[model samples]
Target: MECLLGLLKVKVVRGLNLAICDPLSHSSDPYVVIHLGQQKVKSSIKYKTINPEWNEELTLSITNMMLPVKIDVFDHDTFTKDDSMGDAEFCILDFVEVAKKDLNGLPDGTVMKTLHPDKDNCLAAESHIKWKDGKVTQDIFLKLRNTETGELVLHLEWVSIPGITH
Candidate 1:
């Protein structure tokens, strides 16, 4: 049993129909916070809009594919504590599978045939393949959900390290 290190890239693209936390005002300032394992990253605040385009990227070193990544949307409040808008989560193992194509007894990258929503009630997102540094990278779109109230779009990439197993 050998362990390998993989790099996970998460890009918070945008939000759609986000929750308006401030009832006193017409709109609310919103931002996104992403959590992977013990690492957390926050996107820049988008003021006065329900739909915001962040286009921000964060990278994390991943050793376990069984863990789920958590994403939370919040309203930025200057006076008080930030209000929670909504949240969603997804697991890497949900997309990754053992491929029939193997190299030297190691499995190759598995292709996801269809986009499907996870247990978190998020919309199905798109996925594709990207090559970098002579290795395969799994790129996926993560659609964050606050039930039917709101949705967020995120781009996630899993970069595989050579000679890594499991």
Candidate 2:
């Protein structure tokens, strides 16, 4: 059985300059789906927009920190199947490591670490894991891979379960 590590709250904030999936309309209805092992969560569909503000919060029960959380953006369709917009992923290990340390003296908005986008990872730009509002959190900007044009902004927070034990 997989051991339950803790809960992670991922906030799908918005999309930026998404692809034009719909030809006639010049816009597309987009939604986000998050996959972490067997747990899959989806955000509500935002219609007729390249830049959509979802402000959706999804919680995932993390079993392994090494496993990456996959994110996919899709264009919703009423008749045919939804078209794939793009995909991105992020790991929680580094974020969790910083959260385990003593960050009492750090000022608000202090960046603990900066993760650069590379060929292996889907980060569009420099992602900063910051200490904000008395918690370990991250704001990520991902350039959608395998697509012509698209971007996503996400916020992540790790919550420790106090009574969880092996």
Candidate 3:
């Protein structure tokens, strides 16, 4: 059985009002690391600030849509290990559903959809039929928490290729 591959584009935009784990210290040096199975990518570290702008883009090849992607925020430490700030997880299939609702075809005949962020910081989009080479773009605000408090701003685009099935 030949499985189809999908292209997942993840943009680590920025951090907003992140929690300061080291309150007695000056500030926190924060960075983000995203993982999907064995594939992992890290963003640039922002030194001494609760708010950091990464503006980095990462691409991952996906064979299964059901797998969840994890995004973890950490504070860089020199002597000690990096401290975990917070993390969030999302599935690619959710965006696929959104893409299938609102459909737009490009000049090259590539179908695309746009998912907008809601007032409550939730993400939702429309989709349509014709799954060949379909694309979905979404801007989402993810709240990260694990015994701490923080939020991560991310932009994602999921592209599906035709002629392949998993």
Candidate 1 lDDT, 10-87, residue by residue in tens: 888788777777777767799988787778888999998888888888776676667788888899999899988888
Q: For candidate 2, write residues 1-166 as lDDT tens digits.
A: 9877678899999999999999999999999999998899999999999999999999999888888999999999999999999998887888877866778789999999999988888888888888898888998888898789999999998776777643
lDDT of each: 0.67, 0.89, 0.71
With a 3 Å backbone cut-off (N, CA, C), the pairs that clash in candidate 1 are: none
Per-prediction backbone clash count: 0, 0, 8
Candidate 3: lDDT of 18?
86
RMSD of every candidate to native, in Å, equals 4.7, 1.8, 5.3
Per-model TM-score on C-alpha atoms: 0.73, 0.92, 0.73
Full candidate order by lDDT, most accurate first: 2, 3, 1
Worst 10 residues of 1 by lDDT: 98-107
Across residues 3-23, which tens digit of lDDT does each residue of candidate 3 receive?
546778889998888879677
Residue pair clashes in candidate 2: none
Model 1, runs deviating above 4 Å: 1-4, 94-111, 118-121, 124-148, 161-166
Mind sharing the TM-score for model 3?
A: 0.73
Query: How far off is residue 31 in model 1, in Å?
Result: 1.1
RMSD of 3: 5.3
